[model samples]
Target: MTASQDTIGQICKLLEPFNSTGKVLTPDTEISTDLNIDSVAVMDFVMEVEDHFDIEIPLNVVSETHSINDLAMVVDARTKKA
Candidate 1:
């Protein structure tokens, strides 16, 4: 599915525990500071995103992502790669 059709808002909602507010977050949003999401929470977030997208997000890519937008871009790119 396309990124626009993928419902980032829903993903962000699942990430609410991470302090996301359903915003179009930027790459520099600071996943920890802006979202208050910890390392474990980030893992959970990655799992949720993977399930939602029906894809496997690489650990390295997940580690590289620092924001919602960054994650989205990674997902998009990975989806394309797949």
Candidate 2:
């Protein structure tokens, strides 16, 4: 799979326990609204993503990420750089 696809899959796995809707997560899924992720949860999720991907995502960039695809793009770019 492509890096973006892999990132999305890993992100979906990280979000599974916190996603109350039990809906399948996709790249288009909104991180906050669709996933019902609160601020604290977002931070926790971000940390997990950082650790798993071995990259530090800036808080400003995190705030700008609306959907899973956006996050995946950032991860994909960072991973490529590393």
Candidate 3:
């Protein structure tokens, strides 16, 4: 699969359990408030994302991620660098 498709799949997998009630997330979607995800859940989500992408997400970057789009952009940028 291509990088963007792979990224979207990984995001869907990480977010499926939380947004199981048919919540659709666009590229500009907010994660915390929109998805009702707490800080701890975000941490876990970040770890899952890292594992899924086989890349280490920096703590600083994690701190800056306020939404699914933010996180996906970070991952996408990292993947591109790789």
Candidate 4:
């Protein structure tokens, strides 16, 4: 799989715990709306993602991020190899 795809998949795995509703996670799944993750929980989930990816996601980025795809794209951009 491509790097973006891999990042998306990894994010899906990381997001499983926050998915209290047991929803099927996809790149398009809205973290807050679909999974019903609250603001505090989203921040916690962001911390987990940061730890797993070893890259810091800025507050601005987090605010802009809605779906898993948005986060994966940010991660892919941050971790891209030159």
lDDT agreement with native, every candidate: 0.69, 0.85, 0.75, 0.88
| lDDT of candidate 2 over 1-82, digit per residue (tens) | 3346777888888878778888788888898898788988887888889999899998998999888888888899998999
Worst 10 residues of 3 by lDDT: 1-10
- lDDT score, candidate 4: 0.88
The lDDT, on a scale of 0 to 1, for candidate 1 is 0.69
* Candidate with better lDDT, 1 vs 2: 2
Sliding window of 10 residues with minimal summed lDDT for model 1: 1-10
Q: Which parts of model 2 have CA positions greater than 4 angstroms off?
A: 1-3
lDDT of 4 at 11: 95
lDDT of 3 by residue, 13-82 (tens): 7887766447787665677777778878777878888888788897788888776667877889888888
For the record, the alpha-carbon RMSD of candidate 2 to the native fold, in angstroms, is 2.3
Clashes of each: 0, 0, 0, 0
Models sorted by lDDT, best on top: 4, 2, 3, 1
Residue-level lDDT tens digits of model 1 in 5-70: 264555566676666555445444656557667788788878988987788987787888776667
Model 1 clash pairs are: none
Q: Give TM per candidate.
A: 0.69, 0.89, 0.78, 0.91
Cα RMSD to the true fold for all candidates: 4.0, 2.3, 3.3, 2.5
